[model samples]
Target: MFVDTSKEVRDPNVSAIAALDEPTRRRLYDHVVRRPSPVSRDEAAAALGLARQTAAFHLDRLADESLLDVVFERRSGRSGPGAGRPAKLYRRSTKQVAVNLPDRRYELAGRLLAQAVEESDATGAPVREVLHRKAQELGTHLGEQNKTEVFDLLERYGFEPRCEGDAIVLANCPFHALAREHTETVCGMNLHLLRGVLNGLDEAGLEARLAPSPGRCCVRLQPAA
Candidate 1:
């Protein structure tokens, strides 16, 4: 499964997957994806042996969830001022979706590890050092992409932040399993990552620090002292 960073992304992905759960809709979707070009409602309906209205409803639902892209074009060979109304067409969206329980981000970790290995081999640097640096860079990049408040950003990444007195405490560790097995390495990397986030966002109110607690994240972003 792919890591979706926010409810906005994950909810629609869930809806799209759910929509495909219906047998007819699944068949129609399968057919549409197999085609090289965008398909019209009529084509989808006929191909799937479904009524036009049924096909339209399911197609529109898929489009709503962004599983399908909607396009309009004059399918018929026409020209000039007398060209007819454009036909509405459906095509598989380029968007990729992955939803995971407990919010695992193995793919992100894998990418960082892979890049670290490649760079270390090329430049003869230590793999662990390169990996940590790359992970920090990725965290900074993620923070730079945040268009919302820090709270929203934390929530989006599944940090499960909650206010505790003057500081914010994270209730969940997004990298639970990795941290459990490799405590020092993972926790240090996580700390640097969040520190990079704060740096990238120019957030001066809080500082990411290591303050391991049970049933919660090992790192906390506390009010700067």
Candidate 2:
């Protein structure tokens, strides 16, 4: 999913990826990641034949984007007054960043599926039933966590919600590929998920239902009668 980092609305993973698009910055990142230990400004500069000022600027930028982590330590084994100030070092960040076009959340799906399988195996329950329950639980949690309007929440998750009459149609399905391949299973999960979302949001006005259409999500939100 792409979160416009400039707006600071969500995770900055996309911005972190964009930072590496610069030639020099990408090279500096590559160099730092390959090292056995954190690299200092001087070491990185000398290795890349870049000026110290230029190397410092890019390294700090990488750290700022959270692509790299910053650490300070004394290179010399001295302590007290003579030891001098700690040297700033750069290393690859522990944070993980993944971006998908059209906003596929396969990892989220995988987690739900895995939880369902594990729970079913332990409880001797049906896997499909467990999957739907898990999906709904997650959706409820998402709705409760995000206090925004329904349309904004859907857009944040890449549902691409659109208005049609008194109902909301999703123009893009976040689980497009998976739902296409496993129609019944995925669509059912999606329906329950949105239902739980509405429930958590205390949205008594809208009810989520299955109304599959081409080029749209399987679930549609319609006004409750």
Candidate 3:
């Protein structure tokens, strides 16, 4: 069954996206980004037929959310005492924001795979071996960084962990599509990753192993016997 993991954390990307829900703010953002260069409140106000105050408010809000970057420059190209204060201008920020329901981390998987291939070519080790090692290292680092209970830690990474007797079943796989197409390789990486997590966390009561089911993640955490 699907689990709602949104309540577990407040993602900044979601907040940034929510900031655009306001009609006027969204309009101001669109106008500013479409410009060839930084746009001043006056220019944005005139172009969008909005009041200067309205444009300024929305532009500032966008800047607050990192949706737009703020800059100050003298429009007259003057740099003397008589030039007056620099005008505030807005531009699209370099920050990228993305939010996906059920949470996917294809970038992490891609990076792990790429590192494996590169390291294998350099050391002549098998690609799969390198991949499993790297994945485990990363998982260990994640576990070390987040010193929480295993279930909470799993949930934080988008694994919808649920109890089934003494075992924890994952309702979702963050690398769903990749796992479907390349089961052995991806699932093997996942298994080793979780194993590292347990090792890093010093949790000896549970062990991560491949127990592939029809609709869930291939790896399951069962009570260590």
Candidate 4:
């Protein structure tokens, strides 16, 4: 079956809070999301009930961040064909931000875990160790089609892995710490699935280490087993 989700052009605005206070940042995100097309600095400001000058200042800053690109330059004002200048139009970028959300933290953790370990095998070490041996387990799991499937599965679980030294390391897993706070039941399970995900892959060929704490659950890669 096929479904058509009407295409929506994305707002190329990333959260640039350095110059803007939190409130203004939120307003900017909202403005870009709701705006039909690239809006003039003045229009954006008016939408947020801010002054034109202030809006221009922030808009330019957004452009610097690659979050916005100028689509057209125009001069809008009262006058004639000989008007002083025209305003610029900025179209939203085609990039959109999608957030992963879970209805129940525990359940969400389970789904994440289940997805992470789809390609795990236990050859050495604790053949079926869960929680304690997540990275180890996931190392071995590969797909019948190709290793790419295994790698992709990890990505689906939001595990961005990169090769380092002798092993594959998880670049980022946003759920790592959050799962700990949300509930302990699945945090352990998460580790378990992670292990299963790595299972079967040569242990000695790849080493996975929970990066130094205070990090967002990045598994450092190296030779294992």
Compared to the true structure, candidate 4 yields what TM-score?
0.36
**What's the best-to-worst order under lDDT?**
3, 2, 1, 4
Clashing pairs in 2: none
Q: Give me the displacement of residue 182 in model 3, in angstroms.
A: 1.2
Q: List model 2 lDDT by residue over 110-187, tens digit each.
A: 899999999999999999999999999998888888766788778888898899999999999888889999999999
Q: Write the per-residue lDDT of candidate 3 for residues 14-100, one digit (tens) a residue.
A: 999999999999999999889999999999999999999999999999999999999999999889999999999999999999987
lDDT of 1: 0.83
Off by more than 4 A, model 2 = 1-11, 78-81
Q: Which is better, 2 or 4, measured by TM-score? A: 2
What are the Cα lDDT values of the candidates?
A: 0.83, 0.91, 0.91, 0.51
Note the residue pairs that clash in candidate 1: 2-98
Q: In candidate 3, what residue range of length 10 has the lowest lDDT sum?
A: 1-10
**TM-score-based ranking:** 2, 3, 1, 4
True-structure Cα RMSD, model 4? 12.9
Candidate 4 C-alpha lDDT tens digits along 1-225: 111223443322324333334567547656875777668877888878998887777677666655567765555546767766756766554544333432123345555455445523433333224433543343334322224434555554556655555456665554655655654534444455555554543233443445534434434545665
Residue 82's lDDT within candidate 1 is 79
Model 3 per-residue lDDT at 10:
61
